[model samples]
Target chain A: MSLHDCRKAFSETLVALAEADPRIVAVANDSIGSSNLKEFKKRFPERMVNVGIAEQNMVGVGAGLANGGLIPFVCGASCFLTGRALEQVKVDCGYSRSNVKLCGMSSGVAYGELGPTHHSIEDLAWTRAIANLTVVVPADPAETSSALRAAAAYEGPVFLRLSRMPVPDIHPADYRFEFGRAPWLRRGSDVTLIANGTMVARALEAAALLEADGIKAAVVNMSSVRPLDREAILEAAVAGPILTVEEHTVVGGLGGAVAEVVVQSHPARMRLLGFPGEFAPTGSPEFLFEHFGLNPEGIRRAAAQLVEESARVAHETHPVR
Target chain B: MPPDSVPTDAAAESVSAAKMARRIRRSALQMVHAARLGHPGGDLSAADILAALYTAVLRIDPRNPRMPDRDRFILSKGHCSAALYSTLAEAGYFPREWLREYMKPLSLLNGHPDRNKVAGVEANTGPLGHGLPIGAGAAKAAKITGASWRTFVLTGDGELQEGSNWEAAMAAAQFGLDNLTVIVDRNRLQQGDETERTVGLEPLAERWRAFGWAAREVDGHDLEVLIRTLRAVPFEPGKPSCVIARTHKGRGVSFMEDRVEWHHRVPTAEELSQALKELGGGDE
Candidate 1:
């Protein structure tokens, strides 16, 4: 399978957008190479602002640019951009409601060898907790391109987490992105596997494995985590037990979001799969995913266990049926 | 907008600015005293600079606070919102009666200045080191679109320790943001102690210059000097401007001036009366 980096899609979409709209500007904290904005800078030098490794100032400058009638895409490595400048993101971008697109490049455990300091596993929790901010994690290059356009069209703060690690394209070239809706990738009646970002492709693989074992499974691509697709989650709940997977911590990423919806509207048996609450050790991105049980085989095993648990509970509740 | 084109009646303008400063100081005192839970020291210290900008320096319209071309002013040291509110009210951005609702539950006048709630506020800022970067962004935007409007940001001396300000300072110079100006309310004292004692910020003017800004020092309480210095912005062409205004933490009040404890100290009834008498007591 040919692999694609989502950050490339993000940068290409941003440059294409900038070509059409003069209001589009790219602001970074000296991460031009990491953010893949060198082409953008070369095309529009004046519109590119490189603030030299200052994450907090980068976010604030993005807000100020938005206030000055320009749409600024604040691009940086996700760890520093979201962690170091969390307060600024909360106040300047989130609370102030600035039209700033925070492009968190290399999110999740993409920088695996760089250790926990460079990992942006907490970005989803940090950004989603803030009010008036949209959080998105695109599963593929096509989805990344569409999400970038959607973020630009939406006139408010948005956190777009783009992966630097290469992964196979899961969405077609003509995929249309929606802000708060999940696109069902595969349908089944036995169990549903919910995931996003790098884990969405893995979830599809897990569902195929379940199909081989005569246990049909549904797959959902939940990219928009903040304004989660409640209707999809409720629908999945009625189908079977849900197993949420992500390239983030299980405490407050996709799993937490799904659990909140299920507990509030429709209670159902579920299994949350991701990094356990601990600092990830040094390894490659693939190694970290395998170590955390975020690979297809791991997801398949978790889904199988959840299905069996759901069947046991159902039988205990209504034995005659 | 010529640098030296001070109004022909410069002396009259100075006197009026001085009077406006006094009014703002008194209004801030009353607002803080009414709330009994607000920062008064920085409010009193920032009065003269706020008055000068709102009255003479900034190109703003009270009726059209959202004018895209209007000059941008951000209060980075948002704990002193009482002073900003007083100045905005006196400038007719909103009714003077709204000052009374400051810090009240569900009131638009929050403990911090919220741009969404207040018409004249450019940004919601309570966190330090945020305004300068935003100001830099606005200035960069002006440069991008070839807009003539300038951006001004007021930050407390102690607020400069956040490191984000230095980041903005570098970018402001790198972008050659001649339209941007940063004013530091050098009120020596902060919450715990003097700024120098808490974190040494001495030789601050040279620091700004080192960051590629045209740095200047001025007496913050002097209205005439402030208006003149502010009008002569981009003190040097092609560089961002920095005004380090030396000020007493609690100006106009003898007991509160330069006192560390008065940073957020609410005045007693006796102290309020004494302050009013010293400020030439008059109701808004």
Candidate 2:
């Protein structure tokens, strides 16, 4: 699988979008290189409003730019953008309904060795809680580009959760991203695997492994966490049990989002795979993913367990006595 | 070059602004009294600035609040919604009747200013330190597009404790956002204690200058002085302007003035009547 950094797609698409629309602008908190905005700044020096090393100000400035009739992509490390300036994200972007696109770069545990402080594992939880802000977690470069374009086209505030963690292409070359619509990547009936961001590719691989083990595991790339794909989730619940995998904490991330739907609509057995409460210990991104069972083998095992649980629940509910 | 922005006669404008400021004070007092909840102290403190801006400075029309090139005004010290709403109402952003529904169930006049709900509000700000960066962004946008529109933001001096203000201050100066002007209502009081005792922004003007703004101080209650200072913005050619408007917490009311207890305190009917009398209104 050829690895690709989605931040590249974020900047390239942003530059392309800015080239076409004069209203498109970029706001950064001194993360030009980190946010892959060097090309953006080089191309449109006048458009890049870099509030050096200030996340709250950066987010607020983005809202201000929106108020001034410019569509601002406020790019920063997801940790600072969501965690440090969560209130600004809540009030300025969310409550005000500003036409701002918050580009949370290097989301989840992408900052491997930098420890928990750098990890943006809670961004999904925080941003999704805010009203009127669209939360998007793209699985690959194609998806990232598509999502960015969609966010620009769509009015109001949006938070684009982009990962520095390299992942292979999940969608086809001509893939188009629709907001709040979850697409089924691999169809199955035994158990459904729901994932997003870096976990989607891994979840697909896990589905492959589950298929080898004769367990039919469906894979769904649940990217847009806010306007979540409820139809897809309810449909999946009917198919079988649900196993959710993410690069974030098990609580209030993709798993929690899925759980919120399942518990409300269709009751189903589930297994959520992610870091549970504890901060990521010292390790690289690969080691951390492997350690937390975010790998293909771990996801396969979780899916198999969920499949068994689903079968047991079914058997318990109805018997041929 | 907005219609009715430039003052042909400063004295006459000041007289009109002073009367409007009194009406704003009276309206705010009535709202607080009616709602039984509001930061009346801050409301009274900021009434004159809001009146001056709405009447003489901002190139905004009440008829067309969202005109593309209209000058932007943000009440960053948004807890003083009574004053802002009164000013907006008087300026005809909405009817004066909306002031009666201040903080009522599902009222458009939320405790904090919501730009989505209000016609003239530029930013939804109740949280401190949010307005400057936003104003800086608007100013930066004007500079970017070469638009002649200017952006003005009013902030409570005590709310400057939030570090986000400094961050935007640094950026505004760095970007040379000359179109932006920040008018700080230096009431010198917060919720608990005096701002000097709380966080101490004593060297305020110098601090703004250090952050790369052309800073000055004015008597916040003087309508003519506030109008003149605000109209003469961007004190330096290539820098953001900071006007430290010295003010008392409750400027119009006798009992509430400069008192910390009145920060978010509600006044009684008797006090409202007395305050309105002092403001030269009979509880209208």
User: How does residue A74 of candidate 1 score in lDDT?
Assistant: 96
Name model 2 segments beyond 4 Å from true: B1-6, B281-284
Tens digits of per-residue lDDT for model 1 on A1-321?
898888888889999999999999999888999899999999999899888889998999999999999999999999999999999999999999999999998999999998999998989988999999999999999999999999999999999988988879898899999998999999999888999998999999899999999999999999999789999999998777999999999889999999999989889899999988899999999999888889999999999999999998989999974
How does residue B129 of candidate 1 score in lDDT?
86
lDDT of 2 by residue, B203-236 (tens): 9999999989999999998888888899899799
Per-residue lDDT tens digits for candidate 2, residues A91-142, read 9999999999999999888889989999989889888989999999999999
lDDT of 1: 0.92
**What are the per-residue Cα lDDT tens digits for candidate 1 across B32-107?**
9999988999999999999888778888888989988899999999999999999999888999999999999999
Calculate DockQ per candidate and list them: 0.88, 0.89
Docking verdict class for candidate 2: high
Task: Give the Å shift of residue B53 in candidate 2.
Answer: 0.8
